[model samples]
Target: PEHFLITLALPAETEVVWVEDFYRGIGDCLDMFGGFLAGGETSGVPSGSAAVISIAATGSVQREHLILRSTARAGDALFVTGTLGGSIHGKHLDFTPRVEAAGWLVRNFKPSAMMDLSDGLGKDLPRLAKASGCGFSIDETAIPVTTGSTVAEAIGDGEDFELLFCLEESRADGLLQAWPFADLPLTRIGRMEEDGKEQALGGGWEHFRS
Candidate 1:
């Protein structure tokens, strides 16, 4: 990654200290993710409305390492990193990107397709299946649900920010046995099918819809 760019529309009553604190947090993230504080624009929004913050990044990836969601294959084993759901209980704003885990997996394993779980598994999984021209079968019991979340929430509650990926079923065992992160929980949630009978499920966080 090269730089981080953030654009903001703040309310009139917004405090300057809060902005500094936010930038400081971003700086901390940069230290972990490798990026610079490239400049951005800020403007005032009408009071009593809502404050908006938009972030964007510019980076370059090698053709081989640039994982794409549309490349998932039928019969591939689907996997996800860490527990899901319950982001509303403070994780939405306080979560780490799976940079280290993803980097290691991409370097050592051949994931057929990979993507971050931003729109909940129920939603994003179907999109991935559609793009790859496959149908997915999710094992609800296998989902690593958070402490206070249900299986449905784990599938539908958005903003998980974990890695959802797929690979050949043959490699699933080796990847699990060779996983190095003890604290991080990686689970094989389901598989892709050539004749997709399972329909696409529901999801959360429709930015413009709700």
Candidate 2:
């Protein structure tokens, strides 16, 4: 597994207003590079404590230590953060990270583990399985798609910049109500299981070698 680590140094106690816009730019960079660490630069003002966001991919394919398919707990509810698809339309380069949304989830839902689903669930779910040491059950129709894209295209396309996580089932409703990310098209697509089989229910982008 390889690591795509993004370190951001911003002024301490930064206003909530700018924090999001700041990471959105970073999300843009991630979206541009396919996975991450493809090589790039950072923007925005520099100050205060540096925030490091490490993103990884795990699976049969390896890029140092990025692939980390995690196991899902039986009572865990699956979650997707942010909007999906249509990223190619400046959304990729200008999309906002659900930092506030994620924080809300962490504080409210207490996720067992989390990962950003850049590549579609097709390529990402297996990676998550490897990390959590569990299998997943995907409700394909539950996945949200970008405007003008078909379900097939949305599921298979890469660079969605959405976050996928697992949490106890009982906390699902409260978490959803707390963030209101649903307006952003965030969706609950599935749940975690103790099983270890990797299932590629949706389709995603092809690997460079593939």
Among these predictions, the greatest TM-score belongs to: 1
Residue 137 in candidate 2 has what lDDT? Answer: 80
List model 1 lDDT by residue over 71-110, tens digit each. 9989999999999999868777878789899989989995
Best by lDDT: 1
How big is the positional error of residue 206 in model 2, measured in Å on the Cα after superposition?
A: 2.8
Off by over 4 Å in 1: none
lDDT for 25 in candidate 2 is 68
In model 2, the number of clashes is 23
Error of 1 at 55 (Å): 0.9
Q: Give one digit per residue, the lDDT tens place, for model 2 in 91-148.
A: 6766665656655665565577677778876777677766677777887788787778
**In candidate 1, what residue range of length 10 has the lowest lDDT sum?**
195-204
